[model samples]
Target: MDIESLAPVVDSILEAAETRGGGGDRLSVSPHSFPDAVEAAAADGRVPVIAEIKPTSPTTTGERTEDSVVLAEQMVEGGATALSVLTEPSHFGGSPEALDRVREAVEVPVLRKDFILREEQLDTVAADMVLLIARFLNDLDRMVDAARERGFQVLVETHTATEVEAAIEAGADIVGVNNRDLTKLEVDLETFEEVAPTVPEDVLLVAESGIGSQRDVERMQAAGADALLVGSAIMDGDVTANTRRLVTTEGHDT
Candidate 1:
């Protein structure tokens, strides 16, 4: 495992987190809006919006319009309810600082969007929410424990029923159905189908990847999705226009 091939950047992020410390005790802040954003969305029967700050992706065309930090500010200004800042360095051109910048710029909950590895990554004061991809769910226990221990929330991702089993075993309350395969980058709109049935009754469902149309959003909502992890569709495209459309329509109860 050439941890250096990818893990060092994550290590550096961990070091940065050690420098800032977590935001108080978990039990003390458990009732706060950040960790409970998903629950709140689910309770209100609304669609939570996760603005993924990806510069570019193999599955999608085009690239970021500007620096991720700047783009994150732009997303917030455009009415994003929550921000998902990519912290992966190589493929996504993201950094802990980008997460930090977005968290610093906006009051809405900010999620550290990346392939999380170890407990330390969750302890890093980068963002309030952490993304746990299901393909790697086998290792999710320690990481999820760390996040919960630090009063952070986890968004476990699943691409199939197998991964869904892993997420449920690990007690993930927020699940993401990724439309893109990490290794192959193939996309399908119905990626959530396999995991939808297996999702815990209380867990919040999130639709990820190929969410480009409003109709697509509606369908996911019907499937019990409380949030959408929209990335390339919003990040590298006509950001303002798409963001305006999505944000306005978010929280479906309106």
Candidate 2:
């Protein structure tokens, strides 16, 4: 990834921070419990799915026609354990307002899925969980601390084995192995399977991207993933049915 591709998102977040006086007091906090919600979703011994609310993507041209809030409600009704809302504006066609709308419409914990770089950005958004991409941060530990201070659980996203190690070194409680390589915009399921074992058992492992079917969900679970973060596929069709299919898919015998 050029890394610079995220400059617009960062600029917008920083601008919001400046406008808000660089404090979290102005942000509306979500009451839903993220970790607890994930736990309950996984209680059935099936991998819980975090259905995402994304209208568009830089990698693809087709955008979902449904309203984000309505889609969030449908996903929740379809048995989604948690929700992820895209907050990046330029490429993903997302905004903090979209996240806020979804958070208000659903009871599940909502994750602010954006190219988070600074503490100010974390403070500016209201969500139960925050995403910290390992490769994008100049100071991973500092940003992680910032997220924690705001009472948000961090989902440290990694694309490689080295990034996974860095996430673990930063004491990340949830490690998301992104199957899609951000730089190339390519989806490879094997990436998660190859790096999952390196994560400690105590830390939760999440497989993000390229999960298109029940077999795909099962494969990730078999590779030691505790959860799945599915977006594009769910947004492309009936949100409720898509989420139900992924969540209800049975994995191999443990």
Candidate 2 C-alpha error for residue 241, in Å: 0.9
Which lDDT tens digits does candidate 2 get at residues 202-237? Answer: 998899999988888889989998889999888887
Residue range 106-181, candidate 1, lDDT tens digits: 7778887876655544544546778876654347767677677766777888877777778888888788888776
- For all the candidates, what are their Cα RMSDs to the real structure? 5.9, 4.0
What overall lDDT goes with each candidate model?
0.67, 0.81
Please give the TM-score that candidate 1 achieves against the real structure. Answer: 0.78
Q: TM-score of predicted model 2?
A: 0.87
User: Which pairs, if any, clash in model 2?
Assistant: none
Model 2: runs farther than 4 Å from truth?
1-31, 250-254
Q: Over 4 Å off in model 1, which ranges?
A: 1-46, 123-125, 250-254
